[model samples]
Target: MFKYLKNDLPASIVVFFVALPLCLGIALASGAPLFSGLIAGIVGGIVVGALSGSQIGVSGPAAGLAAIVLTAIGALGSYENFLVAVVLGGVIQVIFGVLKAGVIGYYFPSSVIKGMLTGIGIIIILKQIPHFFGYDADPEGDFAFTQVDGENTFSEILNSFKQISLGSTLVAVIGLAILILWEKVLSKKAKIFQLIQGPLVAVVFGIIFYIMFGSTDTFAIKTENLVSVPIPEDASSFLAQFSFPNFEVITRGDVLLTAFTIALVASLETLLCVEATDKLDPQKRVTPTNRELFAQGTGNIISGMIGGLPITQVIVRSSANIQSGGKTKMSAIIHGFFLLISVILIPRLLNKIPLSVLASILLLVGYKLAKPSTFKAMYAAGWKQFVPFIVTIVGIVMTDLLVGIGLGLGVGIVVILYKSYQNSHFLHIEDKSNGVHKIKMTLAEEVTFFNKGAILKELDSLPKDTHLTLDVRKTRYLDNDILEILDDFREKAKQRQIHITLLSERGEVENPDSYIEFFRLRPKTA
Candidate 1:
């Protein structure tokens, strides 16, 4: 892991800057104590990173779970009671891993996965636009279409224009400029520039810019628009920030239900991120999904014990790490250390950095994930892939992550069924040999009940006095419904004065009486 220290160190710093505000903002959105987010970030980074099989995936408190945490806390009657749920949730996740539930991730289509990445990319860009212009009404980490401030996504963008902070806009522009310069030109010029990432430089610039113009009337960036880390007064006070779970209430009904909910949601989110991060990985390495579940479960357990929000493998931080050229999990581990140390030591300094700078960084990350090229590529892959891909993107933008994926997956299944119906059998008609219509129908490799409609329609349309060869020699599996359809077609064939020949690997039959009996007597051979 240490072999790529130079690469990991710089990437870790970039991920640290990206994760800090998200940790605080997600906590704020969840209505949890702000410190809880940091604790989750710390634990997710260190514990999960060390245990995980993914080389580049980063774990932390997720914005996706903010609403759940909010309701769970209220329903459970106390924040400490909610912590009990989180711990139990971790146990459930571990059980899911042992049961190999992680295989569920593989069941998702590639179109849906790509749609997820693109949808998230679009959400990040839309959500950060307000922050980019210095409108701070919405929390940085909230990814929902509907805002807690009683405003929707587009309305917030309109509001941002009315509430723009000149200083923030100026700082954001400069920060973005520096980032682009470093990425497009400087990093390519020297190893030193690569060792010191552009985001670090931009953040440093943002702090200096704030200190210089934060007091000015026309260009002042307010304290509200900056990164806010909880400041502890002394050693004893700092230690007081940690909250222990109330295990006494673990057996309560509400607690158990909340635990199960958290486990299911967190496991699903982690598996999705694992898939997305693996797609984004430059090395194209596959992450062990079940192992990732175990790692995340372990992280959540530790996080909840110390009063942290539930943890999951978050795509934003993971993408930031990958884009920053992270080579290994060392970057994630080091970022956790950074989170731990900064909150403890230099939180005051951290508070000086502008949120606009971080927003600028995320804008770049979002653009990369939802690049126009990806859309074109998906379109070129054909409607089967494009329909689900587009639907997923729209669903995610209009709703949330999971909902969008579900919508896309549904569309993808429909596309599969339609294709199956169309491809059930291939018809080849010989040109009226000897003045009698001759047709040959070859069944597909697997004919399920969904194929029954197409087969029935073809059989119904057969010409009178036709010689039909129904070939099933190549078919490996035939549904019972299709066999019944064929048996009924035999009577129709006799009424139409059509001669029917059944061709299979077993033998040839003249108008087979019972298709089911024939298949039962001569079962599929290996």
Candidate 2:
């Protein structure tokens, strides 16, 4: 881990900048204290990173759980009660890992996985647009369809723009320009730029820009739009930010429901992040899913204990880590340390950075995830892959992440069934001597009810005066529906003057009394 310090250090700084806004934004979206997000980020990075078996995965407060957290807080009647659920949710996840349930992640089709990553990328880009323009009405990085403020995503952006802070916008543009130049041009210089990451440079510029414009009376950019780091004059004041869960609420029915909701959502988000991070990994190392679950669960427990929001493996920070050249788990670990140290020592300095600048950094991360190449590649894979991929995208866009994935999975299953049905039986025709056409039908190993349609279609397509050979040598089991179809086909073949031959272990039957009787013969040897 230490060998790649040159690369990992710079990447950690970039990931740190990317994670800052998201931590605060997710907290705001969750209806939790803004500091809770930072707490989660810190714990996710340090604790989860230390325990996780993934080389590239990064953990933090997730946007996917914002709705659940918000709802849980209201339903439980207190944020403190919800913290109890968050901790319990972590414990449940650990149990799930111990039970080895992580193997379920392997069952998702490759096309669906790609679709998920691409869909999320698109969401990030669309969701961050308002923030990039210095809009803060819905927080800096909320990705849900409906925000905590009860405004729709697009509407919030419009409203935010009407009250746009020129200072923040100007800083954002400069910060974005610096980031672009650093990546496209400056990084190529091979010395200064490579050592100092673009995000770090952008953050520095943001602070400078804020300081320069902050004192201008005519600028009219409110300090509320800037980074709101809690300033603690002493240790006791700093400790005030930490809130413990109300143990009295632990036995409540609402608390249990909230716990289940958090567990389910956080586990899913962590799985998604693990998959996405693996894809982004340049080395393409596969993460241990069960271990990842355990790590995330531990992180959530620690975070909740410290008045933090529930944690999960977050894609935005992980992607930034990869794009910025993170090479090991050290980068993730160091980023968490930065979060901890900065909040403690340099919060006043951190407070000088504008939210719009951080938004610009995330905008780039979002664009990379939702690049046009992703769509083009999915389309090139053909409709069987593309259809589900597009369905998932549209579903996620129209609704929410989980609902969209469910829709995509449903479509994917249908596609699988259609393919299976079409390939369930094979048909071939040969011209034989004496003007007789020999038709051969080979059934698949296992034929279910879905195979009925294909069998019927093939039998109906046979021409008159054809000699049909039905081969069941490889078939292990045939559905009753298929047997009935064969019986009907036999009667039709007789009417069309088609000669039918059935091959089974019992013997070859030139003319069978019934399909059921024909299939009652001894099973064929492999």
| lDDT for position 185 in model 2 | 98
Candidate 1's displacement at residue 431, Å, is 3.2
lDDT of each: 0.93, 0.84
Q: For each candidate, C-alpha RMSD in Å?
A: 1.1, 2.8
* Top candidate when judged by lDDT against the true structure: 1
- Per-candidate TM-scores read 0.98, 0.91
Report the Cα lDDT for residue 175, model 1. Answer: 94
Question: With candidate 2 superimposed using the best TM-score fit, by how many Å does residue 369's alpha carbon deviate from the native?
Answer: 0.8
Candidate 2 overall Cα lDDT vs. reference? 0.84
